[model samples]
Each structure stands twice: as C-alpha cells, then as structure tokens.
Target: MSDALGYASPQHYPAVVTDRWGRVETTLVNDGTAFGMILRGNRFEGKSVDGLALVGPPVGSNPPTLCDGDLCSCTIEWRMPIEVSLDGAGPSRVSLSAHLVLGDPTPNRGIDSVGVTLTLHLPTGVVATTTPQELIENALLDLQRLLPDGTRLLACISCAFSDYSPAGTAFIGSMACFRDRKDAYRAVSGKRDMYDIWSAMSGVVQETYHCPDFARRRPGSGYRG
Candidate 1:
C-alpha cells in the first residue's frame, strides 16, 4: 500500500467569547482526539520534519552512476513548502520553499560518501550544504580503532562479519565466482599466509570457518580444523 498523505486530518480549536462589559467567558466543547502529527519528509539523523515533499525516491536507493574521486553523485531530491517546523521552534519554521538534494554512493572500490544540499527559494536565500567527509573519516578512524589488536583484515563483501569468518585459503579459480583464471591466479597464487590472502580478497570470498572458543584439543589433533 502507498503511504498516506500528511495533513489529511483536521484540528479543532475552542471558542472564547468576550461580553460588552469586558468580561471574558469560555465555552467548553468536547473536541475529538488530537490530530496525529504527520511528518511528511524523511528523517535524516533522526530529526522529525513536516511539510517535506520528496521530488525523487525517498532516500538511499543507489542509482547506477559513477562518482568522481570521493564525492557522491546526486540521486534524490526534495521539495518542501514554507512553515515547516524543524525542531519545534518559531525560527525553525522555513521562511521560503526550499529544495534539498541528497546523494549516497555504495563504496565498491573506495571510501563511501554522503552529500546534501539545501537551496532556499527566497531572494537572499542562504545555501547550506555539506558532505561532512571529515566527520565520516573521524568515525571510520574510531571504527578501525575498535577492532582487536590482532584483527586480520578480511574483505568478504557478500557476507557480514558476524555471519562468516576466514575458513581456509581459496585459490580464486576454484571458487565458482571467478570468471577469468588469470585474475584468480594473480589474486591467490602468491598468498603464502592466511592473513595476507584474507586481507586482499575479503570482498570476493565467503569462507565460513568454525570458531569454537575454549575447546580442549582432541588426542593427536594437528591444530583445530
């Protein structure tokens, strides 16, 4: 089913009457339930917004376009009317209709990136935009630091870290995934160590290994299989 439109309900307010004697009186009438807040736009970083109209796809759907360097190509656009409350403040209301351009690219070859553009329709409208690449780089640094000191890089793009592990060395052509034997040979022929091989082609493999913690070695077992 399609999503419902925002502002589809009505809100009722109470009536107050003032007499000629300058006495103010109130007429109490039972009003229906409060209108549900319809946030029309997509939430970025968990901020609720209303009067947000999307001109393109909602968000995060990748368009098959190549990005230059680390900049992401524009993929989604938004059109919003004025009087939009961004954070429940009077100044938070939009002064003019505005357009927001959003871009997000899947990181197949390099660092992933995000982009945003805000264009106001006013004559002296302020344009505010940023990709926050520095913030992302800092966050990536934090993520890398979170890994264990002995962590070996693994590049399995198909499987999540929690779902799989390095089982054994996969000579590329042996796995049904490699189309060219030469490419496979170049990848795995010189891989003498497990860590080196895992780091180089982690995005191309799905080698699931058993990780049994704290197990007693069996008699004459040559390393844990």
Candidate 2:
C-alpha cells in the first residue's frame, strides 16, 4: 500500500540533524528491510547542548524503548548539569540556537536541519541587566561542559517553536525529521512535529519481541541437522 502519490511501498528514508554552523551532525537511515546508522558522537553531544537538558536520565538500566514492526525506533536520553547565576548582574534572558537533519540512501540522500532557539528568562535582578555576549558565553560554556566532543551541523531549514511554555511563553525544544525507510525512492521525507519517531521505532520492536513467534525462537538456533 502507498500514499496518494502512487509510490509503491514507502521509500526507505534517512534522518539528518544539523548544527547552527550548517554541518551534518547526525544521520539516521531507514532501509526497507532494516534500519540502522552510525550517529556522530559530536552530533549527539550537540543535542544535549540544546534545550534537551530538561529530560534528565532514564528511569532504569533499560532506557525507554520503541518499535514499529519492520521499522526501527530508538531513543537517546541524557542530561547536562547547569548552574543558574542570578546575582543581580546579568541580562534578563538568554537565547541559543540548534538544528536537526534527516537523511536517506535508496531514494536519495537529502538533508534537513532546522534552527532551534532556546530562551532562558532570568529573574528580575539579572533578567533586565545581563549582556547578550555574556549570557551567550555562559550558556555556551555550560553547553561545552555538557557536550565536550562537539556536534555536527546538517542542512539548513527554517526557524521552529519550542515546547517549554511557562508563563504563556515557549522555551527550547527540537524539530524532528521523519523518514519511512521502506521505499528507496523517497527516503528523506520532511516533518514539522516533535513526535520523536526514534522512540516510536523502538517501541515497535519491543511489541514484536513479545509476540509468541518471536518468543519461541531460540537464540543462535539456525542449523539444518
């Protein structure tokens, strides 16, 4: 089955994540038969540098998982230590920008990186007194501690809105790129939502493994005796 485009079976797509400097940070490929990729360590670090610091860590050893039958989905969660300094000596708010990329190979190899801006509204004392350069430097230094390895900047897209909305204002978040990876003709597709398809893919696998057929299969039991 295919969508209205008449393309038989969906295309095997790839997901890309770029940084503010227009570099390819992460690359996720979804082949029609299997899904896998070698994500750049720096790119992952860059993500943590972004506003993703709020998520913290997984509850247990088995970090959250997701799956989608044939497709592969997974989640990479982590946290960065931050110290808020409000000694009545800095700006009232701080803003930072990041990006994401979606890539594929079968259909074509395209990139999509959208800029994500994070604004930290400070308290009354420093909220209206800090300098843009100083605030940016502090945030970058904190992010560097969190990243360490550096990140990859992918293709450039448009500006996106954040999810953290406190006091009727939005905070920092990520813009995700979706790929089917089932068909080769249309691998790298575009999406404007923050649904985290990677996690969804992992869930699908968990469900499949729970089924009777998969449960009955023994590990390394392939022999024609």
Instruction: Name the best candidate (by TM-score).
Output: 1
| lDDT digits (tens) for residues 78-125 of candidate 2 | 211122323423212232232221112122322122122122232321
Candidates in order, TM-scores: namely 0.20, 0.17
Candidate 1 weakest ten by summed lDDT: 30-39
lDDT digits (tens) for residues 34-124 of candidate 1: 1111112222111111111233334344222333322123322333332321222222223221122224445464325432233334323
lDDT of 2 at 193: 18
Task: Please state the error at residue 27 of candidate 2 in Å.
Answer: 23
**Number of the top lDDT candidate:** 1
Give the local distance difference test score of model 2.
0.22
